[model samples]
Target: MRSTSLTTGYDIAILGGGVAGCVLAARLSEDPGRTVCLLEAGKDYGPHQQAWPQKVLNARALPRDDVWERHAAVHRIRARILGGSSCINGCWNTWGSASDHAEWSRAGGPMWTAPAMERFRRAAVEQMGLRAVPDGEFSLWSRAALAAARELGYQEVDMASPDGGPGYGTPLLNSVDGLRWNAAFAYLDAEVRSRPNLSIISGASVDRAAVRAGRVRGVDIVVDGQRETVHADTYVVACGTFGSPAVLMRSGIGPASQLRETGIRTEIDLPGVGAQLVDQPGIFVPLTPTADLNTSLAAKQASGDLYVSRMLIRAASALCPDGSWDLHINPTAGPPLFGRLPPGEYEAGISALLMKPASRGRVRLRSADHADALDIDPAFLSDPAGHDVAAIRSGLEIVQELAASAALKSLAGPAADGHPAQDLSDQELRDRVGTYWHPVGTCAMGTPDDPLAVVDGEARVRGVSNLRVVDASILPTAPAANTQLPVLAIAEMLADSLRG
Candidate 1:
């Protein structure tokens, strides 16, 4: 990794120290010759981050005073700490379809295509201390669900790359010791933080990307109630889907009309900087467990099934190369009352989400103030083409079928949804199946002629110099599964491009 000079003048300035930025920082710092400065608007991962190992536990605890929680928004999903969303996100590391990537390439972001993404995926997954396994640990409910799918002639497979086809398998989590593993802990926490060339500045909110002469020069930041400026020769914006666009528009680097209307000067004419946002619509199908499998402190300690299940999951990953959506099958103490439950409450209920969503949405500025939250038009049920509605509704159908299966019936009872997963008409299901919290796009990858593309496959900002975006925002479409794995791949590919 490259080390920056103490003089504060560096070769590269990476804004947003989340998963993408942290990975980029670590990868760029590998050179050790060039100076790299990583600026995080949040704080370092402290005791809070180190405490929880399970994603559920972390999710339940993240809203507190932890540095990770500081970056969260009431309507905005994701952690704002050094590791970014990965810190608080469920550690389900699954990839999407090659079809998804092929579409991205065709859409104008060629680097995101499966072939190019493979190398990056290898580097990120291989180096990040995670390994694919053969047999995944699934709860009785989960296994029954897969078995039900199989009975329906849906071939159950891991979502991994096998025969170079669009594979499916269990997810590759960022865990080490039955605990949650995010970007800060996986790569940056130990490596980058220890580097003299890399400096992590947390608790500082980036007002905007500082621009001059149609190029990014630095960032205007507010740290500890004091305003300061930092510059670098090359600037990379890793501030995330919303943050990147927000910063760009505030810096006068976005839509001419939007900027002018806000009394902000236009630095570039790119109108797509904050458009085309895509995320998944999340819906839960609740069912009653046939057997009471709720865990107690004593039951948890005595249950060898938990450990065996996890190992089996890892084994499945090793054995199967075709990555199907990984499972987090567990015996819930009880069903979620308000979409959430205390750690051991849910009784044998499973939370199933489409690992990748085919829908797309957009992010736009509601105002100019740094503290003012941006209005995110996730377009969850409002896909421009209505593909989102169909996909999510189909997913719901799949869930219903699984819930009604004989195997699942033997363990868990009929599925029910207060939001009417069953009662809602097909159109209603499409309208209501909401976000899975995975937001992408708003900085699409397309050709120069493409009006909505903000960056190309190489992550270069369209119509801008010395500036690039390396986050989920570049995705032309969301994957068919969870997002962490794909984002890791994106970071790896962008870093390799920078190195080359």
Candidate 2:
């Protein structure tokens, strides 16, 4: 697995071949003069194009057939590929709140803001066309939600601009030819992949950043068996918040006390390295719609109505902010009861998502191993009394109103959990609220004065030179919607900074 040429020791070394890594490699290699080495711990997606289906079920949920099962106990995500999580991720591309970006700018991420993010998104969508259809069936849930909002007298929430920050007009999907087009196919296509300047090494796990004179000179990576060093002028730890922290801790560059406990010497006492994790709360409410929505959806999809339905949802803004996730209300077309079916049984679920959660959590190394998944304490519901709770609670109340709406009520039965269709008590509702799968801010980009700051606004790890973290780890907080678009935009912005 170790193939090296005297000239291949690149100008830049990118760890983690995810969306950010692919974009950086592509953009960096665009300048043929520069040498870039993209190292992926996961297997290359070059073999299985079948994993690129737009539908969730068709895409490969697990990693490579060989490596997936081994790492199952740790990271539940299907991240062992060139495209990273984008490969199996739902293509919900709704860019989150401008206010969230503004907060990042104020905290430490100076380059990230609504306008900058929008500009980056514009570029990305220009490359991957955005579809927004108001009457489309994919957006039926959103339309229903909007109708519910209207009926309840609550200010209708847009996918992007939850409280008038940025307006999410349509559902933006990462699809090419109506099929799922991940970073491997979209950003790092054959042309980029074939570049001589860009050398991609898959299945190579990075152990630690080799620090000399307080600057990153190379990395200690475990290839087939023995350890080797890959030197680079600039080292970008796009291994994500959790991965970055774990690598840093392993490299003896983290909290002094924690390092001592592991019997490792301290390189840098960055207390905030694994602190300040953030994710939005998720709440789902089941509705007994008048019709069998799931069966109808399956039939329509089978009948070539998939595109039409998706297009309709796109236009309506019912889809998640950028087609990165879905949060519409649709009735289940299949059997209502898991055990036995009641005739004409149907249930549509309405979900309340914070999109941008104000709460933050932390990621800590459970062990010194870089391959080990960090102990993630997302600390969901960290601030139950904060605005975070208010937003989620408001969304829940809105869904209840929507379920009671004449349009849905005329077609559906009473709102229930399906087994027994009864109204949930206030306590029952609060207990049921959960997470939306958007975890960020472990290595938050903020100033040292800020308690939650990890990397500075420039994405540079505080007190460390020649090392930059360019992933969702640097997010100051969770965005209003799906994080892929924002994370990609941040990487683009980081690439520009690195280029300069």
Candidate 3:
């Protein structure tokens, strides 16, 4: 990490040193002559894992430290660290179905086709050191979940492969011995950090890009209460889904009407800058574990081998496209996600996640101040056609069946509430909805003809010559799987394009 006072002009400036930003810095800095600066709004903690906080390194639980907003709404939580959400998210990785790529290809041209992006996906997997769940890591509850899935007739398939259809499988993990291996550990290792051409500046909050005459000449960032402009020939925004659009809106490059409301003069009338927000919403069905199951889970926890979840079912609802799944049936047991349990006791539950939802949301700025919170509405289960609600209901049916399976019934019983999740009304379902934390599509990708497209297929901003957005924000649609690996692969693919 370098001091901002010592920073000067560079060939390229990569904003937001999250997962994608780390990859971009490591990849683009390969050419020593092309200087690159990577800026992060949180602490870097250096390149060594020992220097990172224990909570951030523990893969057994999601850490709330070093996040953008402490104690904020659960759905609005995002990391504010050098490695981004990878430092705090579940260490699991899974690829999306072929239908997800089909949608991406439609918006971003042939480059986004599954076949075209296979190499980059492989590259990200290898670089991240992702591996299958070890037998030791599987708790007694996880074993029962797998058995229940098989009992329900779901075939075992490779969850990390894009060619697979509906099935039950364990996702590849980016954790080794319960230690989270975040993007900084994978991409910006000691060797990469030694590169003279690459400068990583942490605790630098970006205000906006200095856009002049359809080009970004510099970016205004505040560091330690002082503002500075970092000049660069090119700029890439990798601020994840939420932060990316907020940055663009602050730059006066969004809907003119909304910008005016915030007292920001519109520099570019790009309606898509903060529109079309999407995220996966799910409902959890809690189960009461048997005394025997509790004992086994306590033993596993004492042995330091307890993991909340290890396997999941990729299931297709009746309304889902043929040969694709729209729901993820996850069986989790261990420590509760929200609160602590009594000694020797554990929380168990299964979640039904609506993967491909028809509902859309928006991200809008409340005021011109960068410190103000942006209005983010996920709009889950809000589709006019009721497709999203119907899909979730179908998933709940599967969850009920799984709980009733002989394999699962012996380990746990139904919730005391005695209410079948599928029987819930529309309003009830909405009240209980939770996010999968996979948000995308605010700055969607599309061709020039698309009125709402924020960037072109190559990730170049429509009206800005030297600025691009390379992150989950440009995904156009949410993938069926978690966004971690896909975001890594997208960054790798776009790094190649930017290099060319």
lDDT of 3 by residue, 1-500 (tens): 69445348899999999999999999999998999999999999998888989999999999998998899989899999999999999998999999999999999999999999999999999999999999999998999999999999999989888987999999999999989999999999999999989999999999998787899978999988988899889999999899999999899899999999889878889999879999999999999999999999999999999999999999999899888999999999999999888999999999999999999999998888888887999999999999999999999999999999998999999888988888889999999999999999999999888999999889999889999999999988999999999999999999999999
TM-score of each: 0.83, 0.81, 0.99
Error of 3 at 311 (Å): 0.2
Pick by TM-score: 2 or 3, better one: 3
Residue pairs of candidate 3 with colliding backbone atoms: none
> Can you rank all candidates by lDDT, best first?
3, 1, 2
* Model 3 clash tally, residue pairs: 0
lDDT of each: 0.63, 0.61, 0.93
Given candidate 2, what's the lDDT at residue 57? 26
lDDT of 1 by residue, 1-500 (tens): 22232236778888888889888988898887877888887666442554543443342223334332344443366567777877766466656655577668887556666777788887778766665432423444445555655555554355444223322235565654445566777677554566776777777788887677877767788877877777888888888888888888898877898888778888888888887777665555666554344443224434422321221111111111353332222223233423564555454443334434444556667778888767776655664665544544555555565566676667667545445364666567655454556778887778777888888888888767888889988877776556777788789888889888
lDDT leader: 3
Clashing pairs counted in every model: 68, 35, 0
The positional error of residue 272 in candidate 2, measured at the CA in angstroms, is 1.0
Candidate 2 local lDDT, 1-500, one digit each (tens): 22375224778988888878877887878888898888888767563466443342232122234333343432233366677767666455766554566678788644666665566666665544544432443434444444544454543234433234322244566754345567766677766777778888888788887675789877988766667788888888888656777777777777788878777678877777777777666666655554655455445445443331121111112322442322332222233322444544333464566665556677777767766655776655556555555555555555565567765565456555353212544455446666555677777777668754667877887666888888887887676567777777777777877888
As a TM-score, model 3 comes out at: 0.99
Which of candidates 2 and 3 is the stronger one according to lDDT? 3
Model 1, residue 203: C-alpha shift (Å): 1.6
